[model samples]
Target: MNVLLLNPDALRGSDPAYPLGLAHIATAAMKAGHAAEGVDLFSENCPETAIFSTIESFQPDVVGLSVRNIDNQCMRAPIFYLETAKNLVHTVRKRFYGPIVVGGAGYSIFPREALDYLRADYGIQGEGERAFVMLLEALEANSKAFSFPGLTRRTADRVEWIPNVPLASLEGVWADRSLFPPLPYLDAGTRQFPVNIQTRRGCPMECIYCTNPWLEGKTMRFRGPEDVVLEIRSLSDNFGIARLTFVDSLFNHPTSYTETLVDAFLKARLELSWECTYNPRFHDPHLLSKMHDAGCVRVSIGNESGSNLSLTALKKGFEREHIERSVLDAKALGLETVCFLLIGAPGETKDTVLESVCFLDELNPSSVVVTLGIRLYPGLELSSIAAKEGMIDPRQSLLSPAFYLPRELEGWAESFFLDEVLPSHPNWTV
Candidate 1:
């Protein structure tokens, strides 16, 4: 079976992401003896004609759509982005007779709701590599697909989700790298750097706004440290790629595992610049100094909120003081540290936002980026909170942008940072 995987580049409130899940799904499909062609709508200019032409040429038996985000979380809202997605989906549907299956982080969270909203024939809820490939095999076999695992389908009356079994092992399948273009958005600081790798899956953190535990499941699975470093050596030595990013959800989740991996990188002396998110709790200044010696230049921290109350509300185990210490600690190691701040959560208020501002004043990170609250994600405590607080209309599709902040501080926090904090602190920007 030939599968055309569609990656729709919609607005994410977070980073401008690489399509990691789509690449993995393509890998799985190809490994199963099915030819998988990935068309990134972003790279393809979001045109119906280009998609139709590709479909006409490829003549695929399955169309798998990857949706990574639900809305434009940026303060600068691009008008009609959602409408564009709907139109593109509809246009693709008209040209292709194959079943449309939705997957990815955004779609994984609200699998049932998104499946209904998009009129998709099926949705893969959890990990797509296994579930999606399994479904493709079952569909080809003419078997009962509704009972296929980790699948969600809309029946006559209501949608039914086939629960995914727990993942018990980790397999390192070299991803189908051809689907991704050459690193297109490398920071100007390190454009000459070569190949990159995603060494792990799932995050152990239970931050309120995060969907890691639910979407990727509770376990933190990683490839062997030796294997990861070998891949890095191939990138730096053979591919002439000096910069690599480990796009892991929690790069430092298992303290022992990370220590071993960092040691592997040091032993290899790959001479590559790298950076990844690290938990402050596991961060020892000595360890960071070693990483810096091995060419690590920057560190990213998820000090999501500054208020202790907000931290407790969001279940960020660490406190304001921990963050403060972390900032000083990272700086002492000669590592440039950037704080990723989230202003709006359940206990968010004018005062809590002020606390974050004060934190910025004290730590004065090399950079800070702020995002407004996002409340539409399913399988989150925030989802229930939004519903209970009347922030989300029961009948309304939360698919469009929706958030939960203190009603009084609605526009103030986001505007204040853009107008005041970012301007005054040249280091900070959204």
Candidate 2:
């Protein structure tokens, strides 16, 4: 079987993320005695023409499209990414008569809706390494037994979804970097783009608007510290990659594992600069100092809101004081700190927004990112709140981008951020 993996994400941003998930699936397919190829549309100048050309050239028996995001997550000017994905699927269908399977972080959230909207043959909801291989085997044998974790298929009447099960360990699992070359992604822009590496999976934190717990299960899984260090060394020696970004949900959680990983980096003596997102609840000065010493040049704090009222409503698990201490600690160690402020969540008001602005102003990190509204997905507490408040229909499909912003702050939030908050904070960006 010839398997072609396509990355349909073309979202413009500061960096072009290498499709690590697709590469993993491709690698799994190859190891299962199948010919696998990967094409990334993000680096292409014309994705439509490129999709047609790739189908003509590869003539794959099966096509797997990885959907990374549903929208830009910006409420002020939301770009629905699914339209591009659907068009890509249409192009593939026109050129090739093969199974089209969709999966990724974005598709996993709304499996049925995304599969129906994209009009794909099947969809894999969660981690695809194992499930994808099983799917390939089934397709090859022409077997109807499609029972597997995270597999979604369209029946004659309705779409059926099997719940996803998180992998218990990441011991021998590794992504095949050869599928997607590093130079094209690295040299896409003038700003240095870091290669991403995931040291762990799963998130236990229950933030109201977050989809991490849904995409990845609540259990925490860590790769071996030595294995992660070896991968970093390979990136440096083989690819000449110096910068890295750890894509873990919470890099510093379970402080013991983080300390061990840092120690392994020190022992390896690899010269690489890296950054990761940190949870303020696990703020520790000593561990942070060790991380800085271990080639961590920057840290991004996931402080959604600096006001206690909004923080509690979001179930952030930490308070404003924790954010302050984390930012100050990272700053003291000369680590570039970036703080995130998600405005217009539930319980957000004039006073709470002002409190957040004032708190961030006093802290003064290296940079601040402010978002106006929270993207609502189904089965979230915020979605229920939005429905109860008559903000959205309870039965509405969120495949199209829908945001949850308080009515009280609708006209006022955008103006306030533009006039008062953004004008004063030179380091902040919306």
**lDDT score at residue 25, model 1, on the 0-100 scale:** 84
Look at candidate 1 and give me any clashing residue pairs.
194-241
Candidate 1 positional error at 317, Å: 0.1
The lDDT values for all models are: 0.73, 0.88
Give the per-residue lDDT digits (tens) of candidate 1, residues 1-430: 9899876766433335557678778878888899878787655654676788889999988888887766565534533344555566797888898788887777776777777887788889887778888889888988863476688998778888877664555565445555754354344565663244777777777787777788777787778888777666655554466776677777766766777788888888777788877666566666667777777777888788788888888888788777887678778877788887776778788888888888777788888877766545655777778888888765665566666676877778768877877778888766
For residue 29, model 1's alpha carbon misses the true position, in angstroms, by: 1.5
Candidate 2, residue 38: the lDDT equals 79
lDDT of 2 by residue, 95-188 (tens): 8897999999999999999998889999999999889988899999999776899899976678999988888888866776877766677764
